[model samples]
Target chain A: MPETIAAVSPAGLAPEAEVYTRAFARVAVERTDHEPSRIGTLRKAAIDRFGELGFPNRKLEEWRSTDVRAIATTTFSFEPSAELVSEADCARFRYDNTHELVFVNGAFRSDLSRLQELPDGVIISSLEQGWREHPELIEPHLGRHAKFDNHAFVALNTALHENGVFVFFPRNAVVETPIHILHLGRGGDSPVASFPRNLFVAEENSQGRIIEQFATAGDTDTGGNHFTCPVTEVVLAQNAVVDHYKLQRESTDAFHMATFQIYLGRSSNFSSHSISWGGGLVRNDVNAVLGGEGCEATLNGLYMVGGTQLVDNHMRVDHVAPHCDSHELFKGVLEGHARAVFNGRIFVHKGAQKTDAKQTNRNLLLSPTALVHSNPQLEIFADDVRCTHGSTVGRLDELGIFYLRSRGIGEEAARSLLTYAFCADIVQRIKDKSVRRDLEEFLFRRLPQGDVVRQAV
Target chain B: MSLLEIKNLHVGVKDAKILKGVDLTVNRGEVHAIMGPNGSGKSTLALVLAGRDTYEITEGEILYKGEDLLEVAPEERAREGLFLAFQYPVEIPGVSNVYFLKAALNAIRKHRGQEELDAMDFLTYVREKMALVKMDETLLNRPVNEGFSGGEKKRNEIFHMAVLDPVLAVLDETDSGLDIDALKIVADGVNSLRSEERAFIIITHYQRLLNYIVPDVVHVLLDGKIVRTGGKELALELEEKGYSWLEGEVHEEAVAHA
Candidate 1:
């Protein structure tokens, strides 16, 4: 790569995107990874779209509260690595009984990954191997759910994605245990950006759980100065039941932009938990479409941030058919100059009657300096639908604190206890016992008087 | 020494003054009743005594156990055996009632240089206090005061008063929203907790609560000042005859002074 290509913004694109444009051309010529020919056309279109849309600015209504100048201007390597960087200690985050898939620096590590004996009709492997072995299986649903026509980050991720995870469950396969994906971002001497992608396809009547945990190696507090752009697409066939959880615990200084696109068929019950507790500048776009009748979609998110961190969650639920239901509950807590934004919209398409949809977004500011912009919008084109949306932004309940303090608890303990209670609204909704327990343990460590909170709740 | 003393106490919120030039004294084992009309600062006095930060004490001093009570923090005040039964108990979701009381009790005990109670021991101790208020066992595991009926919130306040065992417990309009049956039950809860080592400063808008638990002294507060003081019969007189008569006498006194 020439130094001139990295220094200047090429043809009005951002300098950050310019580096990727030059790097993409080189990677495209010398690529050795295996994928279907359809992906090649998808990547070309995505790169062209990336050149056009560069990066989002505050002028856009969706990106007003969140500023992306640092992500657009900073130069990070788009490297493809075969050697493992850090020791990637992931023992503390493991669930008791489940298959594990490991990805280090956006590159799949088969030596570090594990899988149990699969029941028939279940497929789990790296997308690289999955495409190499069975391109037919990867062709139909590869870029189906999440298209990058309008989203720049999605386009950028689509153009430069490394081998991520590929999961397939044939019709009527009921697996008891969850599949855990641990993506670790380790700090090197210089900053690097990685685009990690995952594709999940479940056939009719299948039931299972999936957990995605993105974290820094060793859980260190500093030197995570990297960028991760990940896009995940999930397709659930009719009558498929799936519970998904995404825990984003990147390093405190890491930049993370993620997009989750999910589509549901008739009578499919899908629930997702999105938890973001770490990262410097983080933005997540979670979009779910109930495209078939009698589909139920539940989306719950919790974002707890402090210390000048900024987290933004953009959610959209589209009821595309009659008798479809969607429920969304998103909560955030911020302190110490931290800022958070929650923009949730429930769209009821024409003739989508009996489209029972509910959306709630609440934010708690622990410090006066912290701020939040909660926008919950509803767009209904149907005449007879039950759709409601509400949002609230407030500090910890002062009167409640006064009541607790008057009863002999210290003011600090009371505040921590109340904050825990506020977060429990979404935490308790997680159906998996092991996942919920790990989340509780992770949350308790961050709050003071942890023992009291452990006992009180 | 007196259990609590307030000399020429002047309290205010913002620029509006409340509890103007109020002086009072209470000894151990004495139950003093403060009866007043609406906006007469009965609730204000209770909150100020409990060290609520919303109120500013611009004049005079408060002494408890011969120490400056106003100098202590709210939690420190609670640990030093000061309790105020809130007029409107707060509903705190996700904090169970049993766990909240245990935490409160443990904090106070730690301040007294005593060891913390284990879960079983705390449960046993709290059950005894709950029985005094006739509280249902089901309410123990529910979030603190959340979705509680008006009567239940009042009983929970007294239940807390019994468990914390404060040296000076101020009941701030605890009988305002209770029915006749709930009022008697609350009064009985207060009566059972009375002893020689503790005192009660019961503030009420009506004297009906005084019938169940007779006060050692009754004081009528009007327009931010205690205008009259008497024995238990004063409550009876005010119950039969309304506060308008007392307001008349206060107006005459003010005119004479002017």
Candidate 2:
């Protein structure tokens, strides 16, 4: 109804046009019912902004490693799932000890969710409710953490997503239990696209943990293509602590594009761990801002890519305040024709003195054909900070294997042992017992054979 | 008949010979101490005997019990009762010490055609062995040799040797990093595991460890060949006289014997 929002004429473009001028027309009509009215206008504005800037290519330094042509040329229809998720199918993902929050097709399913009792001053509600009830609290920090201009996928997530989880902890509150939210992809027999967004705000001196899992419940071996576009933004207020984790295990034929943005206030501690297990082509964009002095941020991730899958995780940590510390460790195991790319960047601003940042990206190649590319970059503007970045791409240590075999461990067991060891450093740092146990078990089952481990994908 | 025999053993690494025409024989229940200066092929001999792939045998025949030992793989050789406590134990991260030892022990047991112990039984078995080395129960649950002190690493090796219960134990400079207290514990562990059916090759540079676990035969190795073979007192003589005493005639005698 707004005059600022424009609808492209049907004659101007096909329903599957590759370029934005024609493509936006189809996406606009297709996502009309799902996209909120206010955010839809904002999305149109952001699209116009991108049109002014144009698409970034290899010429842009940041886009050198990741090519957007493959994603840009792929025509994905904004279709929703026709078949609803069943209770029995959801049981497959249920953990023994977790407060489950189920989201099917980007909409919350209250019947499938099990919310435990919350302490005083804690709020867990839907973003749709927040948009109407807590507009002041939601509007200011909704899209403030991540820079939408840098990435098209995140911008698209912002424009189309209508429903998501909104979590907020009041000042000085300590919520001991971890909140688990499982996002299920359940659009059967058609090409479906979902945009699920999340916003978490930890008030001053508050403490909590959130575990987010994204899984696909469609035919993986069949040619059913599902597209999932997700965004999660977390804000840690002064002296607050947050442990955030995101698990992406979609159907092998699905396309998953996700973004995780976090902002830390003074003396706050924030840590995020991401695991990418399944997807036809998956890409994760994570950005964290160290906004205050003495803040600490840790980013840990493990990804296993196999077959023809292309999995990429691009992250940047901005050190804006002095005396801040950030530690990042990402491991990949790749096999078959799977390809993986990791680009981790640490930016130490001019005023961010006394900053200590350490980043390491390690990859293991199980197959000679599988490809892995890791680029850990450090941009230091301040002379007083200590920052180090390193990337290692190698096969399993032959001597270490021989040492184990000489002690009577079989070749298979020995290789698995060392591969587990390679990933243990990151997995051990996760504080949540249930989350850590689930991930460790998942990794153990998948470690011995996978493109992600073989190729360090 | 000897329990182990090495005939005309010639081993090399990267096309360079490290052990040349080395011949030795040991019967059951005997402990042979091979001593030499650093880089004088002491560790190389131990590695060659343990079937490490880093070295290729140009010409040799190693008879263990009866079959050819050189033809077997290192792990198979280990299954056949050959154990090597490395001079520098390799650190295996993520794999707990207890898990590694349990797998190793089970592999050995399977090779001996015995029933495998279950998880609880294996834990109990290792608990008793841990006490032999005075090792704490907590260390067993940790990553193998990760963040372990040098002495703890040596003690873990001996503890593993006890678990595997190998017929032939080769301790290569196991006492190098150990203090007097750690040395006594490790030596006591090795002594307790000793039996008439098991033979040991204690490889060391100094005679200090020999004072703790006295060997049946002490062989002074100079320039890849044994220059002298004597009793336990020979270690004390070597400690006092030093290898410099055997520079000229000892070298001549080794060459003549070869």
Candidate 3:
């Protein structure tokens, strides 16, 4: 692929950037009826921002370790194979008694989705449908928290995201069942690309849980390369409690880049678990902002990768209010020649006194060749705040292995048991029982003695 | 034939030799107590018997059930009915104790051409064995030895012994950190497991534990060699005189040979 510096502008642009720029124009012209809508203005501004920023190069501070040039120069067509998906393909991803909303190649599939009659104030639908039906509810919080002024990927997703899930609950609307949004990537004979946007809004005093997962639907290996770029935004009002889970297990031949942003109101409690069984190349940014006083946030993550896969997780938590507490725990387990990066930053503002924040990142390398880069940073401007951060990257516990081997477990089985044991604490922390079981299933699926582990654990 | 035979055994770590020219023999249905000071090689002998590879055996031959014990791997040694109750039991987080024991017992049973025990049978088996040490049922569901008290850890090792039912059991300082009551409980647990098919080598720093479970033979080890061998009365003698007297005797023997 040639770096076709499109003479469309003074500055040189890569093939993908140029292609997306042209695609954005065609989309803008096709939506002539949307000229007077706020979405039109948002898209226009996002496109302009994408044009200026282009795709991030290695020179940028954040993208220094993760190289995106492989996908940046390759030309990707927006039209992908809409592989015939049935209820069977979606069944494997469903947990017990969840309101599932399925998407195929970034297109909403109501046929595979199931949502029972919810309470009067709760709204869960496709963004395309929600925008058309409940514009009053979708207008205010769509692009408010996830700003796209400097982030090129977020800007591109904001401009071109076709469809995604929209979950909204008004004040005090309690939902008993979990809302699951499942995204399945379908590859074709050529490199295919899609942008999925998700928005979640929880009003005052509401309680709920959400599980957003990404996986491949059709022929994952034989099919050509698939690029999935997604951006998700969640807003929680005062006194609401929510538990969110994101499990990303894309095909190894695919590229997954995502941005998950969350906003919390006064005294609201929110927790998110981001599990990455990474694709070939993945860069996931999970950021949370505490905007009100007395709020609590728990952001935990686990990433396991093998082969030559590269997974980078960048996390940021902002303590903007007084009497707020935030906890971040991210762990990685790498095997083969896989490499992973973990960057956790906790930022406390000047006036945010009485802030309590903790961050920890641990990595276990199963093979001698595997590599991990872990960095946990704290930037506190408040005097009365308590903050601590720690990181570790090393091999599995040798004594633990010897203990098991001496107990009649073979060496291989001992390692597998200990490997799964390393992930058990995080799995046990999942508040949703079914989701925890599902995570357990995924964690053990790749292990050698999975049945033995399941039986033993 | 002896259940275990160690001839001219020497074990060392790095440049330091922990055991030198040690010779011992054990028969079935008998309990042997090995008494020594802190720096003696009692634990080294126990660990080497369990096939821990950290210690280098420069010149030694250990025969267990007429097979070269050094050639077998640790797990194979366990499967062949050899057990070691570690002085400091290893704490493994996230693996339940019940599951660990069941996997171990099934492995042993399978090696002996027996079928694996299902969960129901295993639970029944475990509850019956728990009574040997007065173990709490709640500890069975917790991680193996993690967050367990010192006494609980020792009792857990004995519980493992009862479940595994090994042919030769080596206890390494099981009574080091236990109170008198806990000591009696562990001794009772060990005594109840003694049968014609089983043998034991109990390593201890104190003679108080021997009061509860009297050994048929007592060996005094000094400077990596078994310097004295006697009946259970030797434990009472060591308790009355302490190890300094034994050291003085060995020193006088060395001087006389010189």
Q: How much lDDT does each candidate structure score?
A: 0.86, 0.79, 0.86
Superposition error at A339 for model 2 (Å): 3.1
Q: Write the per-residue lDDT of candidate 1 for residues A1-457, one digit (tens) a residue.
A: 1221232356567666777788778765355357666787888889887777767767667678988888887877767453644334766666667888888778887777778878897888888888888777778888888978777789988888877888888899998778989887777776778888898888999988999988877545884677889999999999999899999888888999999999999999999999998889999999999998999999999999999899999999989989998999999988899999898989999988999999998889888999988888899999999988899988888878888888899988888889988987787788878778877887778888877777677
Interface RMSD of each: 1.1, 5.9, 1.2
Residue B180, model 1, lDDT: 97
lDDT of 2 by residue, B115-151 (tens): 8788899978888888898998888888888988999
Ranking by TM-score: 3, 1, 2
> TM-score of candidate 2's chain B against its reference?
0.95
Candidate 3 residue-wise lDDT, B49-130, digit = tens: 9988889999989999988999999989989989999898888777889998888888889899999999999999999999
Instruction: Give one digit per residue, the lDDT tens place, for model 3 in A418-446.
Output: 88888777887888887777778876788
Let me know the DockQ for model 2: 0.40
Best of the two (2, 3) by TM-score: 3
Which pairs in model 3 have colliding backbones? none
DockQ of 1: 0.68
Q: Highest DockQ: give the candidate number.
A: 3
TM-score of 3: 0.96
Q: TM-scores for chain B, in order?
A: 0.98, 0.95, 0.98
Runs of candidate 1 exceeding 4 Å displacement: A1-14, A28-33, A80-88
